[model samples]
Target: MSESKNIEVSGSVMDGMAEKGGVLESPTKKPPTEYTVYPIRWLVLFIFVLYSASNSMQWIQYSIIQDAVVKYYGVSSITVYWTSMIYMITYIPLIFPASWLLDKTGLRVTTIIGSFGTCAGAWLKVFSVPQDMFWLGFAGQTVVAISQVFILNVPPRLAAVWFGADQVSSACSIGVFGNQLGVALGFLLPPMLVRAQGTVDEIAADFRLMFYLVAGFTSVLFVFILLFFKAAPPSSPSAAADLGSSLDSNFLQSIKKLLTNRNYILLLISYGLNVGVFYALSTLLNQVVLTYYPGANEDAGRIGLVIVVAGMAGSVLCGLVLDKTHRFKETTLAVYVASVVGMLIFTFTLDCGVIGVVYLSSIILGFFMTGYLPVGFEFASEVTYPEPEGTTSGILNAVVQVFGIVLTLTYERMLESVGDRWSNVGLCILLAVGAAITAAIQPDLRRQAAQHKG
Candidate 1:
C-alpha cells in the first residue's frame, strides 16, 4: 500500500498553496470568509449520474441482445458464451492503455473519446452488416470495452477530486447504484424490447432497434461531454504538475513496484478469483439448472432475473453501508464469505423442494456477489500511495478484466469438461480463497496507511 496524494484543502488554504498568501490581493478585497461553491462541481456530479445512466443503458442493450445474438449469430451453444467472453476479452486488454490515457490526457478528453468509441460501436450494431459479421461484431465489442474503461475509471476519480472525503463514498455508492440499476434495466427490458417474430432473424431486427436506442442515448452523452467536460479547471495546473510524470520509472520498473507491493499483488489475485467465480456462476447458472433438470431453462432464467434485482438492491445497500462504516476491507471479505454461502445453496439446495428457501438463497447470493464493485475500487483508490489513485484503480480494473478475459476464454470449456456442479463448487472454494487473501492483506495496508499518516 502507498500513500494517497489527495489531500483535504479548503478554498483559502488551496489559494494559499497556489499563491504565496491566503489573502487575495485585488483592487478591492472582500472578507476572508467570503466563499462561494463552484457550480461546475455540482454539474460534475449531475453529469456523473447522467454518465452513469447512459453507461447503464449500454448494459441494457447487451442483455437485450444476448438471446437475440444467440438465436441469429449463434452457431453453437458455445457461441452464446462469446457474447460475454469476447466482450470481456477485447475489453480487458484496453484497461491498461485506457488507464494510461486517463493519467496522461485527464478525464474530459479520455471520457469523450470513450463515449465516441462506444457510440460508434453501438451504431455498428444498429445496422445489419452481413459480410464478415464476426469481425464487425468484434469491433463493436472493442469499442464497448474502451467505453467501459472510461466509464469505470474516470467517474470515481472525478468524484474524489470534486467532492469532499465525507461525500466521496456516497458519490461512489450512488454512481455504482446507477450502474446496477442500468444493468437491471438492461436485463429486464430486453426481453420485451426484442419482440419475438416467427424467425430468429426477425427478432434480431428488433434487437438492432435496441442497439440504435443505446447508440442514440450514448451519442447524446457524447454531445454533453463535448460541451461540459474539462480536463482541468480554468485555474488548475496540468495533471502532470498535480501528480508528477511517471516517466522517471520505466514501465517495467513501475510494474515491478506495483507487483512487488504485497497488498497490490494480493488485491489483484483476490479480485481475479472473485471475477472468475462471479462469471463462472453468472454464465453457468442457467446451464447448471438445465444440467440438473432438462426442463429447467425457464426456472434458471427466472432465478437469474431474481438475482439481478437482488444484486441491484445489494449494491445500493452496500454503498450506504460503505458510506457510513468506511470498512472497505472487512465489507469485501464479508461479501466473499456470503458469496461462498450462496454458492453452497446453489450447489446443494437447488434440488430440494423448498422453493422459498431456494429463492431466498439465490437473492442472498446475488446480494453478496456484487458487493465488491464499489468497495473494491474505493479500497484500491485509497490504499495505493505514491501512485496516483487512477493508477491504482486502473491496474485493479485491469486485473478484474484479466479475470474476465480468462472467464471468456476458458470458463465454458472448463464447465463443459468438468461438469457444471463441480466447476461451480470449485469456483466457490476459489472465491473463499480470494476472501482470505484480501483479509490477509488488510492489516498490512492499514499499518502502512497509519504509518504514512503518523
Candidate 2:
C-alpha cells in the first residue's frame, strides 16, 4: 500500500517539497546549493569611460583647430566659439529631463540612449565637413552636446552602482578622468592633424579625415556597449547600492530635500565656480596663447596637453587619497586654495613671453583645477546620501553648465575689451570666492561611512 501511494505522488509536487525542504533529494544523490557571482563591474565601468571620452572629444574639436576651422568655414571667431559654447548652452535645460530618465530607468537604458546619440552626432559631422556646411556641423555638435547631458551625469552614479564603497571615489575619478582625457586628446590631436599653416583646401581635407576617424571610433564603442553593457551586477556591490531608490517616491519632494541640504548647496556653488573657470580657460586657450605668442598654434596645443596631463595625474592621485582617508572636506579645500594660487601665478605671467613660466603655471593650475571635479562629485555624494546620486550630480553639472556659459561669454567679451590678462584677473577673483565657499562645506563623513557599512 505504501509503495503504491508513493508512486501515485506527482514528481512536480515532490520537487516543490524538496525546494521547501531546502535540499533536493533523489534516490541516488542530493544536489549541492548553487550561487552565482558576477564580477564584471569594472568592465562595465570601462565601457562608460570610453563613451564619456568619445562624447568629450567632440566638445573641443572645433576649438582645438580654431584658426583652421575659422578660415575653412569663413566664420567669425565668435561663431566658431559657439560650436563649443553651444554644448554648454544646451546642457542648461536638458539636464533635468536627463536626470529623470536615469533615475526612473536604470543605467543600461540611459547609457545606450546617450551612446546612440553620440554616434549619430559624430557621423553627422563627418558628412558636414565635406561641404564646409557650418550649420550642419553646428547641428551635429548640438546633438553631441545633448548626449553629454547623459554621459557627464553618470560618473558618480556609475561608481556608486558598480563599485564597492572602498573603491567608489577611485572609480568615479577614473570615470571623470575619461572625460578629461578626451578633452586633452581633443586639444592635442586636431592641431597636430590639421596644421595651421595649411591652405584652406588642405585644412578642409584634414578636417574631414579627423571627423571620419572620430565617427569610426565612436561607432565601434557604441556596438560594444549595445552588446555587453549590463545595468548592474546580479548582487548589490555596496551598502549604499539601493540608496538611490530609497528616496521619497515624490520627485519634487526629493528635489526640495536636496536643496535644503546646506552642505550640498555650498558644494554646488563652489564646484560650479571652479568648473566655470575651467570652461572659460579651455574655450579661450588658443586665443589667450595666440594673443601672447602669435603663430604658436602647435605651442597652444602643447600647452593644453601639459595642463590636461598634469590634471589627469592629479585627479587619479586625489581619488586614491580620498579612498584611503575619506577626507572630503579637507581635500577639496586644499585643492581649491592651491587652484587660486596657481591661477594667480598663471594669470600674471601670461603676457611675460616666458614660455617656461606660462607652461609651468598652467600645468600647476590644471593640476589643482581639474583635480577638483572628482573630489566635488564624491563629496556631494557623501553629503547627499540616501538622495539619488544622479539627481545631485545632474543638478551640480547643470549649475556648472550655467556658470560655464556665463563665464565663457564674459571672458570672451573681456578678451575683446580689456585683454586676456584682465580676463584672468577676473577669473582669479572668482576662484578666491570658490575657495571660500569650499572652506565652508561640512560633510557628515561619519554618517556616510556608517551608511556604507550598513
Give the per-residue lDDT digits (tens) of candidate 1, residues 232-269. 43332222222333234333455567777877788888
Worst 10 residues of 1 by lDDT: 234-243
Q: lDDT of each model, Cα atoms only?
A: 0.61, 0.83
Candidates in order, TM-scores: namely: 0.78, 0.90
Candidate 2 lDDT over 252-345, as tens digits, reads: 6768988999999999899999999999889889999998899989888888888888889889999999988888999999999999998999
Candidate with top TM-score is 2
Residue-level lDDT for 114 in candidate 2: 91
Question: How accurate locally is residue 103 in candidate 1, as Cα lDDT from 0 to 100?
Answer: 70
